[model samples]
Target: MPHTLRLTVTALVGLVVLAVVGAQAVSVEPAATPSTVVRTSETTRLPAPDAPNVVVFLTDDMRKDDLGYLPHVRNLLMKRGMTFTEAQSPHPLCCPARAALLSGQYAQNNGVHHNSGAYGGWESFDPSSTIATWAEDAGYATAIHGKHLNHFDADAPADPGWTNFDILLEPATDFENFTFFDGDSFNDDYVTTRLDERTVADIDTWAGRRPFMIFANHVAPHIWFPESAKGDGDGDRGGRLPPAEAAYAHALKGITPRAFKDPAFNEADMRDKESIVSGRPKLAPRPLKRLNLARIRSLLSVDEAVAHTVAALERAGELEETYIVLTSDNGYALGEHRFTGKDRLSDEILDVPLVIRGPGIPAGTRSARTVSLIDLTATLAQLMSLTPTMTIDGEHFVPTLRDPEAVGLRDTMLIQTGAKDPSARFPGWAYRGVLTQRYSYARRINNGPTAGFLYDRRQDPHELANLLSDERYRAVRRELERRYRVLADCSGTACNRDFGPLPRPRPAR
Candidate 1:
């Protein structure tokens, strides 16, 4: 059967199944309101005077430096809000990172360690304890418009916490011919434009009601391959620019990051690094650069979407009260270290850009605090003065929002790949690590291999030098390994405690 025909049949069957199951699904009750909630030891602030609105603009496969290409994001968000310089995606994979953001737990606790059809996905994620449900219980209007989880279909009912849900029903590949479940029926349209339109309409409708939490997820900048280009050797599928933004392609043709195809690109060894990283195919530098430019051009549409959404909020009289956050599900590696995509433990894939602008957040501020996507759930819960029923692996970073100079909340961030799920694209290649202010340490898991890595981030930001075998740094490696072992299995509030203080931020050169 044709792909479209299969999808149509699946969607029809799913709709019928959901119609019967939806009525039997239990509704989540709102948790008891707390008068005074203690978030952390150093920071204790009052809840908002009224529930503040939140709008998270989540882009797919966006890197930290890619924000430079987005003017509206810089002016509206970076200039007006706090920019977290050290923000990272805990797991650095699509489904795992998204699940961590919503559940406020690490991949181990959330049970979504990889994308759908591989180990875990929507079926493994526990939707009953998400930020949307908590916000709904707090008497705030909630809606999520755009990409939800990988492989999500009509069989999956809308999250009970959301008053409105418009989610993508197919794999996020084609930019123009994607289908969406708009809380009632599945419709095909241009993905980004449709999402922006739905977001603006929702803001207008909910502006008069209680505070709203809107997640505007965009599908720009992700790789798309035309049917004709999929099996060709031209490599066009990995960097095809969207047709709507063809005009902007020339704007970033010559612009490339300094680290593009740097010294670490495709080192010739596998004994030191994990099989997934060291075994990647090598590509020419020029083609990788071209692909990077194409990726940047695709992001122009996302910038336009951000501007329109902000304008909609302002026109609806909720601009000042709204908290606008811009970030990505995971960072992409464009020919960095000879790797073209994510699923590795490199900084290029783990470090994401996080900007938050809201009522109390200071303007034109920058923070060096080490934070993760998991912390978003706790931050929103505390901001709205609602207590969550489940134990979360994240801590509220409101203190940093109130004070940019505030000390970092977490001493070390636990990073890992998917578990030993044979369904994964790279099965049995799992690894776990810990990232501190100055070092990164990772080792293979499930007895796959004895490969391990240790990088002194302070001296080698690009992670070119591996110090795991160096006798001079043996003590440092041991300490990092000890921390990683303890953190890889941690859960609940124990994962949020400060293991140690992060190094002070260095001034920009």
Candidate 2:
């Protein structure tokens, strides 16, 4: 049998055992109150008669600044919502980031460090301790649609907390038609359109009856039907763009930051960095521009889907009672330092956009606070007035939403890549670091020699220069290393304290 199939069988066996034991021990549990609450200026907000509804739209591999291309998102969400300027994906990989968001734990604690390995992806994740489970136990209807994790298959056992589950089995090549299992049956259709329709229908069905949460995951804007994978005689390989979105080709120009194709693209700086960075293709300007445009065109449907969802909520009379959050699982690297995909400890891949509009959140405000995907779990738990039963590596960022000027809950944010094992999908991608407002630092772990990276964000926002070897920044690098060590293994409240407040946002040039 193939390796993936063998693993799936093993995992199913484990899940059956777990389900049997869990069913026996499970009992009705009372909802718990929020563990911590931060004061805000808006104390007069009305309490909800029931739990507030939550709608999360998570896009895959979307660049932070790409939100400009989606007008509906900008006007409806950003103009009427609060934007977190420094939000990041702590672990910029598909499986690991999703796992962290669901479990509120870092890859080290969650045991899903890489996209595929002995301890990676869905099989290793403990589904019983996810945000969906927490919300379901709190008496809120929960559903998840779209991408779940890399390598998920038919044999994968259903997650216990979700009342409705529709997920893509694996990455698809044909963007126009992809297979999805909608709880009861497997069907092939245009994924983006299907997901949008199902989401609105779900809202129509559950509105005014109960508090519900729906996670609409989009796969667009991710690389689809790459040239390398095309015409291999596989039925999956075909055109990536749907016919409706073809008109958007080259709609917007691609952005080339100062670091794009820099002299240091693949130059040997440190021994450890060379193993992963060297020999990679330098991004060609023309091709990179075209690729970036393709990404934007792919998101047009997602933008339309957002508009439809909000309209559906309004029609259902649930718009005022629902919290809408727009974000991405991870950011993509486009010709930044000779890279075009994620899985590196760089700003290009780590920085993601986060916008939220809800009952108590301020409107038309921008926050410079630094936050991460892991915090989503804690934020949802608090929004529904439920305490988590498991220890998590995230803090409630609801205060930031309530008051954009409020001090950030976390002082330092942890950014990481997956394991470096030879069996791992992306070997030598292992690294962990701490990101502050003004600096980004990383050190290779479990592979290669003691390699370290340090960038002064204020001086080089694009990270064109490496200051790790500069004698002037020696003391700064040492201090960052100390903080990274302290946070690398932290969990729960230990990871919630403020290291230091971020500097004010920089003035536009």
Candidate 3:
């Protein structure tokens, strides 16, 4: 037995040496500037003959199971490619997640660190040097449709010339009010219908000859939408539910989702409500329900829009060539943790669905590997065989797409936020978590002097249980805490307080 143990240790040591040597041999050279990390090898760069056209369909505030995917959406994806089981939005908000997705950077690295009001907006970014520009430079026509929550500077022109075409479906890119605020909202059916028409026209004109990138964003399953508040007596002017959604919502007959059927609400959520009402002087809670109903009702139209968009691609003979990505900007907090919207760091807000289908990507496979939204930039650039304009926070998920058993892919992900008073000592919170098949460990750093959360995802997927003090998970907690610090350093968001001992989250009484 002793001899066997010695042999095992020797084998492990030899493997470690080999791994170190391999890393040293294959790792790309570091960049001259500290902020940049460039890949120097040709293998790390995009290869020429395999580039494919890209189309990203971004949606707003949609849940994982909201789509008819899995046996349904899964069937569609398989017929057309890749679906990620553990895809995540960088931050659980409209602006920050979108900014990260577009810039291929985290909230801190990108100027738009938080949702609106927290860090001003994305106009602080250089409009000319976005991911769209990089794709455009690579000989792809770029265009955007649907809601534009990433906009910051209202005075700035609607189109920043990033694309050959710009189609604003409404007055503002975001549809928090559900009103079109421009021409007739229904004249072109739903927003999805408009996007479908425009995309089809572009494809027909181009005749599938030129590679193109279209960011077809949709606003559905979000607040102040068609189903959020239907019967509540509020002065909301957002009466813009499409016919299908109106029918579904009408069928609901005042039955809210299982999450919001309760009369009692979370304390924190109520406090937030009071603060918003005091600050903004919005309508009462009853009216808010009506708005929520409206938002919910609008989803059917969006879903149908997705179906039509896919059909349009098929009609254009570009179905196999075009890579379709169905994703949400972020998840919504229907009622979990007493939160009604995104912006707060909760699982419902951060965990988003990412379904992809195209050539070179496998179909009907689901991987549990945690992935970030910004990774889309690198992945798309790789698919097109074009050099990324800048190194991004997102890693290439090509390995996961090609083989479910890819090596060296991440088993953990770090979620950070800069939405804090920079003047404070421990201003922001940083979450470092290791997600295994059954468990997820999320440790909070610098969250209001002392705050953190831990979840046993296997049992409490909703995150109702905060097992920070459950001594049984001591080893797991310690390991996750260490990983958090190491990742924070690697990501360059490491703060002095990040190394501090993590506090156990208190349970709700």
Candidate with top lDDT is: 1
Candidate 2 has an lDDT of: 0.69
lDDT of 2 by residue, 1-509 (tens): 23453344334433432342221111111112211111111122233466899999999888888776666676568877899888889898878888998889988788887776665667778877788777776766777777786546776666767777767665443455456654332234345767777777778777987788888888777666532345322112243532234434433443443334555443333332335564565556775666666776677667767767776787778888889999998887766666767878888789888989888887889998788898877887789886577999887788888888877566777888876366644443478888887899887775443465778888878776666666677677777877888887888888766766433333435
Model 1 per-residue lDDT tens digits across residues 1-509: 23453344335333432343221111111112211211111112333458899999988788888886676676668888999988888888777888989888988788887775445677778888788777777777777777786657676677667777667766445666666664323234455666777777777777866688888888767776433335221122344654444435355436655455456666544445555466666667786676676676677667767766676777678988888999998887776667777767888888898999998999989999888888867887788777777888887899989999987556888988785468544452377889888988888675543476888888888787777777667667777777887887799766755666433333335
Q: Report the C-alpha displacement of residue 448, candidate 1, in angstroms.
A: 5.8
**What are the RMSDs of all candidates, in order?**
13.2, 14.4, 15.8
The lDDT per prediction is: 0.70, 0.69, 0.53
Give me candidate 2's TM-score against the actual structure: 0.80
Ranking by lDDT: 1, 2, 3
Best-matching candidate per TM-score: 1
Model 1: residues with Cα > 4 Å off, grouped in runs: 1-49, 183-189, 225-250, 261-276, 279-281, 420-429, 447-449, 500-509
After TM-score superposition, what is the CA distance of residue 11 in candidate 2 from its true location, in Å? 51
Residue 368's lDDT within candidate 1 is 91
Clashing pairs in 1: none
What lDDT does candidate 2 reach at residue 500?
Answer: 60
User: Sort by TM-score, best first: what order?
Assistant: 1, 2, 3
